[model samples]
Target: MQAQKFDLVSPEFKRNPFPVFSEMRSCGSIVQAKLPLIGRVWMATTYDAAVDMLRDHERFPQQAVRNGKKNVAGIKWWMPKALKVLTNNMLLQDEPDHRRLRGLVEQAFMQHSIEEFRPRIETIVDQFLDELELKFKQSGSVDLIEHFARPFPLAIICELMGLPDEDRPMFSRWAQGITNSGSIFSFLSMIPKLWKMNGYFTQQFKKCRVNPVPGLLSSLVSAEQDGHQLSEDELLAMAFLLLFAGHETTVHSLSGSVWTLLQHADQLEALQANWSNIDLAIEELLRFLTPVQMTKPRIAAMDMEFHGQPIQQGDYIIALLAAANCDPEKFDRPEVLNLLRDPNPHLAFGSGIHVCLGLKLARAEMAIALEKLFSRFPKLHLAVPEKELQWKKMLGLRSLLKLPVKLA
Candidate 1:
């Protein structure tokens, strides 16, 4: 029998996806699906198949099927031309191009280099927690998303990007506009803000070229000025991707961890009993939560058989990372939220050369944020019931709209 078809963005899929994902897994590792706006896609519903698709970039290229310069299925035709600069980003490149773009900033994100920022991150967390505590005392409850989760990583990214302190609010606004790109209409709604953000980054690049300093943006400027390794558009695209991704994913990751920890008291108590279980606990949470639910469509480079399934050239392929993370074959008791599930190699940050560059930094930030939040507020928990809590209505991202908590 042919596999069942699903609407990737349906409200049913958004509410409780695991059961549906399990159904998808049973149907086949690769199930046919339709996404809003962009038509058909092949959703990889198992761990091995998802990894195979992600890691094999040669057969499944990162770049979308483009008609000369136009994207085959991207932004709408009416959107302004300025937003096209978002193309050529590292995540959308392959081969030497991907290697070159990723290498430019990988040094700064090296685990060791990121380790240097641990103390700073801790200090930031404590500072935010202090305010969050005050808010809890005054209001009797706190929205963790607004109070801590959002600002925690945003501050870090601002410092890393050398964004001025006053400009963080503006940057946050622009990022919200950019990451809310669920459909063509939503993206269309955000275009004015996107254009503003693009122009802002463009101006910053020009300024950085004249006056370089010690930060990722400055590093890009130095590389461009010294070796001309990056073009103007590439530099803008890199900065744009970093700003949106650096804080956005981390914010969702932190909030999702907190939400699940609060819900699963056993897991929460487990982590509290042995803080050393943090590393393992986080891995499990990442696997269980899988912040990035699905990856961008990786088009088939040529007509080929993918895992016994016939795929044609230019066919859209999507790896259901959330499904893969929870695959029963890959992890023992994948449904159970076991905090100490070692060897829990989840596809949260994805795989292959296009893997998330900020993985280490994200891990460090999440560790510190969760540790301090729990320690400071042992009785910390959800103010709203699980069903009442809202998840962002995004097509491919699993994130909370807000996490209201009583930090007493």
Candidate 2:
């Protein structure tokens, strides 16, 4: 029997997606599905399929033009021209372009480089927690999303990008606009904000060129100026990609970890009892939570059979990362949240060359944030009933609208 089609953006899926994902896996490793803006495409529903699809760049390239087709996955006719600046990022590139774009700023996100920022991240996390504590004292409750989740990573990314601290709030506004892109109409609504953001990036690039700063942006600007490494559009695209992606995913990852832990009190207490294995525990949380559910759409490079599904050249392919993370074949009792599930190879950060660039920074930020949050508020509990918690209606993201918690 065919599995029932599911709307990724629907509240039902957001509330409890495991059952639907299970049904999808039962059908096959690959399934045909329709997305809000991207129409019909193949979805990699199991771990093996996700790995296969993500790693096979030759067969399934990100740039559709490489497949001898012109139907770009997410780009649409109605999309504002200005928005093209953001899509020119490395995420949508293939081969030489991808390698070239990635190499330009890869050093800053390397393990050792991110490790150097650990102390700074801890200070920032502590400062935010201190404010959260004060807010809880004054108001008797605090929304973790509003008070900590949204601003914490934003501050870190802004500081890393050499963006002024005062402009951090404006970036949050722009981030919110991007998160609401679930449907064509909603996406259209965000165009104006995106245009404004693009303009802001242009201004920042100009500033960096005139007076080089001490962060990643200035370095990128220098790369562009010296021997014309990055083009004007690519520079703007990189800025948008780094600033937007740097914080947006981390925000949901941090908040979702907190929510999941609160839901599974046993796991929460287990991790709290032994903070040394936080790195392991976070892997489990990332797997269970599955932030950034689907990967960026990959286009088929030729007519081929992918896990028994005949995919035409240029047909859009997306790895249902959230589904793959929970595949029972890969993970034992996949539905259960296991904090110390070692060898837990989850695709939360994807696989292969196109994998997340800021993964190291993201992991470090999450570790510090989670450690301090629980240690500081041992009595922290949800302010509202668990069922009352509302998630945003955005597709490809599992973000809580608010995480109200009480502090003793």
Q: What tens-digit string does per-residue lDDT give for candidate 2 at 1-408?
A: 232457777667887889889888877889887776777778899999999999988898887765765647655555667787687789988888888889887843442388788899999999999999999989999999989999999999998988999999999998988787766777778888888888888899899989988788888877532344788898889999998899899999999998888888988898899999999988999999898899988988888888998888878889999999999888999999889899988999999898988888898999999999999887789999988988888878988888999977
lDDT tens digits, residues 196-256, model 1? 7787888888888898756788777666322647888888888888887898899999998
CA lDDT of each candidate? 0.81, 0.86
Model 2 weakest 10-residue run by lDDT: 1-10
Model 1 worst lDDT run, 10 consecutive residues: 67-76
What are the runs in model 2 whose C-alpha is more than 4 Å off? 1-4, 108-112, 224-228
Q: What is the lDDT of candidate 2?
A: 0.86
Prediction 1 TM-score vs. true: 0.94
Residue-level error in angstroms, candidate 2, position 316: 1.1
User: After aligning candidate 1 to the native by TM-score, how far in Å is the CA of 50 from where it should be?
Assistant: 0.7
How many clashes (backbone N, Cα, C below 3 Å) per candidate?
A: 0, 0
Q: Which candidate has the highest lDDT of all?
A: 2
Candidate 2 TM-score to native: 0.96
